[model samples]
Target: MGVCGMLRVVQTGIGGLDVYDVQTCPVPKPAIGEILIRTEFAGINYLDVLMRRGEYTSTPKLPFTPGCGIVGTVVELGSSVNGQSGFAVGDRVVVLTQSGGYSQYVTADARAATHVPEGVPSDKAVCCVSSYVAAHQLLHRAARVHGGWRVLVHSAAGGVGTALTQLARIAGCAVYGTASAGKHDTVRGLGAVPIDYRSSDFVVEMSRNEPDGIDAVFDPIGGEHWLRSRRVVRRGGIVVGYGMRTIRTAARMLVASRGRRFSYYSMNTRNVLQNTEDLRLILNLCSENIIDPVIGPRLPLERVHDAHRLLTDGAITGKALLDCR
Candidate 1:
């Protein structure tokens, strides 16, 4: 509040990062179709961690703040930005941003934000962008899952995984999920049949259970997992690949080998090209309620490095959050 300053978590141009304090850039003034928000919570995503490590495809120039979405109260509104954007000063809103969310204040294009319904916690609304939207898109759009279908979701206890499982069940599909052994029960509790990804060949197990194979596979892990995913789906069944956790794993291994031969650019480009529809479908699903994101551990803005380490290490389930305020 002093001098209208805002605190933000910024990348320091190093591989992994530590926080730096910058006086709030002059409080962003709203232009037409824009609104200023005092952010209450920001969603931390795997993409953020990847960006911090210089591994994500869409890395921002260094010394930038990292946060993708926010749940906040509108503090100022520009002329021509009102009911059409569905917000006004004092309105509770959730905004999606490519970056710049880990701050005390944000200026958003009104069209890109949603008003949070009464009774929804700010923390929960933060999940709508990354987790819920991803889940909704994967099941309803990419996979075209419907009643009577059988679906398989990987990392079932995690954010997108859990959302997909719940949404699939709501849509009357039989849901199966793969996770670490320790998370199987949690997956099952969410109405998914849990498969232990570590101890089992999921493709073989799924085939044995469904016999006809599953109608779709929602996978964020690529690399060798895609081979198995292809096998688990019935003929023409869709495999929606959103993240490349497997590729990241492989990349890390390649970093350790002096003569490792592979082009990160080529591989990532191919991966993105192949998954364009999948991402489009994810976006569509968010406009509807087929999937709802599961919020995970919430950390303060300054501890973003710890958040990244937790995500990379898979130490936490679901999506991690940054309470920017």
Candidate 2:
């Protein structure tokens, strides 16, 4: 909350980053089974770009706030939010809102919130909400990767990419990441073999490295990229797609899936229970140092335009967060 009865938020219409603007309005009140959070950090995801550009199939109506996840302290709880919700005022929590997370304060469903472990940092906990959750599901639920398996993660140096690599290593699988040359060291440091997707043909590179075909390929870069990803996966292995560039890209992926397994993963509230459980598991992993989330550049909420610019220009590695405090 700001002075008066106001709160500041990043608002935008359906357009490019330039359409984004910071404005002040009355602080939002929680509805039944909702919680109001004094936000600490909000994740800046690639999905935001898709939504901003009107490329995503679904999006909020014009003049809306765009943010998918956040880490904050619960400040108020609405009616019927009972003890079982495990939320109390001043308790730190991470939430997956799918929108409205870029404000100084936000309201989220109590059921969609998870308590952050005592020792976990806000930055790391925020990553667990969307990036790590998606990575965990893509591997455990979609790909069903196991120990001794080899997997390739596209955008290996990005937020979800970093999470995928780290979690894969923890599961005793060998990991290969395709990233720009500059991010190779970061990928390699995560115990993954880095392939420069810009300079080298990843399909050929993976073929040379694994020859027998790799176990799984986790790709968010859709379209013919999925076709290329499919070529490297072993006969029994699968290609999991998450991000969509376009409907045609999705169609291309499905057509390319012939004679191979192709699975698509989306992080949504349809399975709130499973997502909350996985988020808690990821927070615990972060607390124990089992998997350290790679945090990249952070900017104050007012500088959100720059944050979006950094993400769009591919100038960020790992997760980029907006400091909402």
Candidate 3:
């Protein structure tokens, strides 16, 4: 915890988490036009899970720290970085780091970081970069959802789901959300028509309720769920596939249900390529404010294992966060 030393969670090459105690590396010296941050909080996302499992299409080299979004106070600035350019030494900010968020400190391109408003807590700001920004990008820009549109969002109680539902409602769209039965009320409270994905055929239910069909479907649960989504969306209605949660779940379930006789890799590579394009649409929603991500259970840095357990167990309602300070 000394100024000259740092504590970081390192990913072992074998796909395990290990905490390393090292002399705080010199506060990452900011390069020209960069800023150093004393991180206060970090957002743990599903991408982090994929990164850990070595399942993501692109993986960082081994032994790297994993954290994508962070909120902190600026501590140092590079000479080419203007302290007065809408920021100062003490400014509260959130950064979209490609990595390095699991540590106590970070250095990032000044342009990729944004100053937080006065009233928003650092934790909330942390949500903005990944969850909120992603939600905004997907719903408004990618989907082009608008008033009177009928939308269906998978994982409604989740971070991205919650954000999309809220923003859709704000845009005057009617939203239907899928979640476990236990989370239905939570989704309803957010102003979405809730569908219990565990017990219902969402496509059938939506068809029964709105036969004209949905205008857009926000599906992070890819794989088989993609087919189900297609059924609910009207022709020309877009289905945005951002995550492989459904595919991963299907793979695990296939192993459990068939007792080692099934493999989930039968899907074609063309499908994967198309799915990535769907994700790009979600990213475009960020600047439009349509998908605002929801903040879920938060844990201190020391409890990272607990956070991982909660996420893996499907017990959290939204994105989990690591309070790094």
Candidate 4:
């Protein structure tokens, strides 16, 4: 603890998550147009890992905290916080903190923070802030998929993949998802035709079946995987790369071996920013039981290392949550 009142936080002075250490820092004060939040849970994502590793396109400076989305209670209101926005003390809200979310408390812009709908748990609501919105934008904004369209989704068992599959199905599209053989059934349950990428070549399987190719391909696996993904799309079809796990892998390997430099920065999430309409739609869907967040595991704050490892290794299905409270 510090001499002054402070909060416990997980911070990284170096580029890797291995450098993460606990420290007591003065609790941040909410500034104008901001709200102080007591973090109940923080949503971890591939972006968090990239940000931590200093490989992401937009990363924080050194000695930083890395977490993308957070669900918490508004503890204090900033002076310029407008009452017309409907935010109040004690309201349960979700904030999309591009950084500084891996902590006991965080401050967020009032306009960007949204109240969680009743009945949605903090763990799941956390996904809606980024993961669900990512899927939403990929399908609707990037691809403009329509009813009866044939869509392909990579990593179909993961958070954004599951969201993409379900959203495509809801849009009346026929989804073809690529995943490991073990996750085939789970992908099928999400209303997608599962392609076993481990045992079979997805490009050949998809291309041979659909001679015209697919309407859209949502690939989080960048690098060579991105090249394959682009091939599965028709001339006019779209290929949207959200997370570049594969590209980041090669970049890490290059750095470790002191080899040629590689960049996976092009596949970051700048294209899938915040959308108020999509947030409202997601929350409404949760309330009506139309769309549900598929959570993989809930790890305590201390298990953050395990959480990141599990996500990086593809050892778990669905979204992972960090229990900060």
Which candidate number maximizes TM-score? 2
Model 2 C-alpha lDDT per residue in residues 64-116, reported as the tens digit of each score: 88898999999889999877778889899999877898888888999899999
- Pairs clashing within candidate 4: none
Off by over 4 Å in 2: 1-11, 246-248, 252-258
When superposed on Cα atoms, how far off is each prediction in RMSD? 6.8, 1.8, 7.5, 5.9
TM-score of each: 0.81, 0.95, 0.82, 0.87
Question: Over the stretch 222-258, how does candidate 3's per-residue lDDT look in tens digits?
Answer: 7677667767777557677677864754333422231
* Per-candidate clashes, comma-separated: 1, 0, 15, 0
- Of 2 and 4, which scores higher on TM-score? 2
Q: Clashes in candidate 4: how many? A: 0
Model 4, range 225-313, lDDT digits (tens) per residue? 66667667776666666667656443233221222122222323333234666777887787788988888888877778888888878
The candidate 4 region of ten consecutive residues with least summed lDDT is 256-265
**Which stretches of candidate 4 lie above 4 Å from their native place?**
1-15, 248-274
**For candidate 2, what is the lDDT?**
0.87
Cα deviation at 282, candidate 3, in Å, is: 15
Superposed by TM-score, candidate 4 places the C-alpha of residue 103 at a distance from the truth, in angstroms, of 1.4
List the global CA lDDT of all models: 0.70, 0.87, 0.71, 0.77
TM-score of 4: 0.87
